[model samples]
Target chain A: MTARRPYAGLIVAEVISDAADDALVLAAGMTGRILADLGADVVRRRGRDRGFERSTELFLSRGKTMSNESTGELLGRADVALVDGAVLRERGRAGLPSVSAVLSLFGGALAESDRPASAFTAAASAGLLAMVGDPQREPLRLGGHQEAFALGLSAYGGVAAALASARPHGVPVTIRASLLETLVWLNWKAVPLEGYDALPSRTGAAAEWQVLRCADGYAVLVYQEPDWPRLKAALAEPALDEPRFATRGNRLDHLAELAAVIERRFLTLTRREIHALARQHRLPLGPVWSPAEAFGEPHNQARGLFEPLGVDPGVQAPRLPLVWLDQAPARQAKIAVGAA
Target chain B: MKLLEGCRVLDLGIITAGAATAALLADFGAEVIKVESPTYRDPFRAWSAQDEPDAMPPLFRATNRNKRAISIDLKRPEGQAIFLRLVRRADVVVENFRRGVMEGLGLGFARLREANPDIVLASISSQGETGPDAGHVSYGSTLEALSGLAWVTGYQGGKPEVSGRDVNYPDQIVALFAAGAIATALRSVRKGEGGSHLDLSQRDLAAFMIGDRFAAASQGEIVTRQGNAQHHYPLQDCFLATDGIWIALSVPASALPLLSDGLAVGDSDRPDGLRKAVAAATAARSAGEAVSFFVALGVPAAIVNDGNGMMADWGEAWDHALQRDEQGLIVKGFPLQVDEAPLAIERPAPQVGAQTCAVLAEIAGYSSSEIADFAAAGIIETAR
Candidate 1:
């Protein structure tokens, strides 16, 4: 049986946002291809000029059919339309009477509606708060392209919402997504928690919850309220008997002292030995794994989590993070899509 | 207010990395029909409370809400036949297998395109499907290391600490990108263009998170571990409140003068006074009051609320979590507008192969005898 078609094979024309970054345009094009995979009959639209990267075919045109036409011509057969950066900037400012026009030998009549349009910007609503004022004086650049990516995510939601809302309103639904908005939302929600500005600080062997430099390798030591007694008993540390080191609050207040005590206890223990002890105590524990360590980890292997790929027919790439019922993505397809 | 009321997606993926992508798709009103195996189901089906042998896991429920699940053994020629039919009707197929696994099973892009040339196919991977490192093995943690995120996420004078107890940050990043890409692609398709292939690497997605660090490194800057210490703003960091919980405070540099005048705890020249004053103020007030004081002044501040805090907040202001069972096994759902649509929560995650027989009968147009034979031959698992 075939999957249910959400829309009756209504021919639709799709257009992407032409922005400064080719990465986004390429990514958007690839995403369009994925949407086609979901059942939208898709066609690829190119910009007026080529980008700095000649690899648009490899990146964006993968899994998609190519097409060339003016925006006006494409819009005629389009029942659904996907638009990007150009819509939000000039059209809104210029105050166009209608967002779209009809193609005609002799103009019969034009149909238009002004119901609200759903827009998805890579930026979240919250992310926008940072860039409210001036780009020059108080410019807010995110630490990364997360803002842009988030906008992309929001755009997906906005497109669906707009499409959903439009049917009832009898209007041609258009969705707006921006990179700026997604970042704003993520920032507002997760706001770098503290020192999020700089490169995340690098911690070496010792973590807040686990110790890494014991034995030749590293070990994860987990301690919570339930496991503290077992840890104290295992280490035979008398300081654990002290009132100030007994409760969660007491231990936190005197964290430095407690850390020292725990360090002293761990000094004589090997990583393997400690891991065994942790297991016996039912504490959450593991090893500080490098890629090599991960390859040999029994738990991971048992889970059948690894999915190996062939970069070339002879050359083996690393195992991937996903496994599709003992299957991997098609490498030949990647080549066909011009990924290489 | 189904956000994606008219959107449709064919989810040809499994487990967390791909499930996360589909789950996010389901959150917005995209009709996602998840293709699972008849034998094992998705791996998540077996992951549940250890005590409840037949129940689906909470982790699966958290990510797989609001989507239909179907079972088909793609290895069987008939199963491949069924999938091609579905492909002809699908708008998107998001799969994150290693590499070449799809082709080996005869379910490659060629087969998919044969059914529908206009289909958009997104093959998510640990590395990518191409390049020298295309075949590298990865989990969320491994991706973190390759992307240099794990390189810089730890306390001062310590080795890199791995993050995430169960969920991987890279997986979420991929899902976010996938969702965004599909939205843009739909726009293109509407404009009479074919959808494009999105080649997103978990490594690249992870690297994007630390772009600032890479920029700094390009300029030959070495950043050392400072824990929660901020560079420019003296007192901008997570500090211990009186209640012993961590509170993140972002005091503007311009507020240094005001802070000095109000607190009177530090000297004008002693830069350490800022830390001292914050420490003092934090110690004097309760966590709530201290947060309120800073919040009212336009200072960005928040409590480092743990799982318990999360639960409490969910119960109070939003009631964001819903109990899936009588025993109060809860699943998290999306919270949009206060009075929009009633939350759409489905049954908890499926037990492995729990829906195999039903799915085969309904989606695959298979009879009971056929399903029984497949189950008997170890090709599939039967629900009953």
Candidate 2:
């Protein structure tokens, strides 16, 4: 039997500022998108000149209705409100719903700071950029708006908790999530560990788990200390049996040579072949795939991971990551746009 | 009131993906009891504490704080019985074991529900519970590679890059999403919905993070890595400043005129030209001057900070992402804050079986004699 959607029969007001920081807009939109996907009647308050790319707009606006309602009108009917900091400031807490999630650039002590920040700057401030890419080169931001979307995920979690705990007509709950805090949370390991002298930093090739070139493309060589013997057996390469590569510490000392030895073997095998071998040996090897390749992956197709956005047959977005084993997938609401 | 003040969670999760999820719930005020087995310790406990053999590893301490812990030999029948007794009182059970480990231990979702009808069993895994790769072994970077996130994360025209072991991106983010999903499920149960088996896959969540790339790819957009350039910005890249610091800067289309005037770059339409001009201009100025110059012109800019610099800016840029415990050690903090009831670190990480006797006696209704018998038989462990 199909179970009811977790958030069915609820209304969410999404008021995002068009001229706000790009990350804030993206984060607010993503929070609304999650609510819409989870069966909420998410009404996205339309903003003039919010020139989002077609793909971003299509992905973030899925299952959400476009409306030109005033913030007062939307909050009057909404059970929850997802807004950017700008919108939250403009519409004070007096008129908000029982639950609201506010997205901003720098939260906490600097919540009111007007510092010019985007996702990249937030990532930089959070120390996320320093954790990726080659340490010798300039720090690189993670692909896409991870900092902002992480804030969105954090906001959604806070909102869900608020909903779970809310008493009907009780004191309004406001969740403040920011790109800087979210990124810092995600990159928590970068923080200095007490009594540890070595601070965490980027280690490109020296990384225990690294992406090395394979025959067809690239595969990330990942394994714990216990998997060393199994990795040696899986690779079937005599060079890996050297004493210098025995322990994790030893391997770290000879990382470049170790990576070269593994890459040499990987270059002889395709990603598919390497993946099969990884499965056979119970190794955690990962073969990097392009988005196009991943779209048609057999496992993804079997799991029904992606679905068309309905408005455009060619465009697709992933279903909500959560899967209720006994229930049918949540039905997508038809797109509705009121007068702008 | 705390968000989950009255909730109880039995956390069988280990390592990042599982343990962090439970930790987030504990931060939200759930009474999270971390369940571990005597025969097996969380791998994170063994990470980087070689100097102090008895001390909890920093990684484990970061994620396991605010939760009580107990050790049980679930392989024993008596231990399973004791666990079921705790299950009867738990509102949720979270685990990230290999696909069949729970069923092998006779504590699968069905058994959990049989013990407590409204139990929310969150099975967080590298893959879904019942897929072809469901039983596949994986780490965080492996999921990033397989889920198409690595495909998007790289230098332009370079091979795909993983966040590596240090910042296993997939593992950290999955905890956030899973916590939210668990909270949502709890809400459903509160609405009189029966127990739910939440099949959350880290790989699937990794894919969802880059859903826009997939959307564009599906429409034949040829979504390849473009380095630091985002479509929303006319020019964006990390440039070296005169002081040997790298400044990450983004110039919106609206700021192009100011950027052109500041950098003496004529053609804002040419992203390549603007990028070069910005790089040269930043190279001529100190990082502070470059960042301030850009900020004054309504451009987003910052010095790409290393770990120490990031920590130094804790108060100004952020406040609570990392906090000091009673011992004055830095630990993981909240990603979000609630205005009414802010989350906090109420306690430090527990030793194995630290709360076994108290939880067994108070929550499981086990008498001292029964607890002693179980302890004597090696069915459970109690901290000395």
Candidate No. with top DockQ: 2
- Where model 2 places Cα greater than 4 Å from the true spot, the runs are A1-4, A166-168, A327-340
**What clash count does candidate 2 reach?**
0
lDDT of 2 at A53: 70
Question: Which regions of candidate 1 deviate over 4 angstroms?
Answer: A1-340, B1-3, B156-158, B223-226, B229-234, B265-270, B315-328, B335-343, B346-382
- DockQ of each candidate, alpha-carbon based: 0.05, 0.50
Tens-place lDDT per residue, model 2, B250-273, is 777888998888778787788788
Model 1: CAPRI class:
incorrect
Q: TM-score of B chain for each model?
A: 0.84, 0.98
Candidate 2 has an lDDT of: 0.85
- Highest TM-score: which candidate? 2
Q: For residues A1-340, write the lDDT of model 1, one tens digit per residue.
A: 1222233343344455443233244334433433453455656566645322222233233335556876555645555444543532443412211122111000001101111111111221122212211212111122223333333344434443443332333333333333322322222222222112321211222223433445544444445456677778776878878998878788757755675667666667775566566556544444444433433444434433232221222211122222222112222221111000
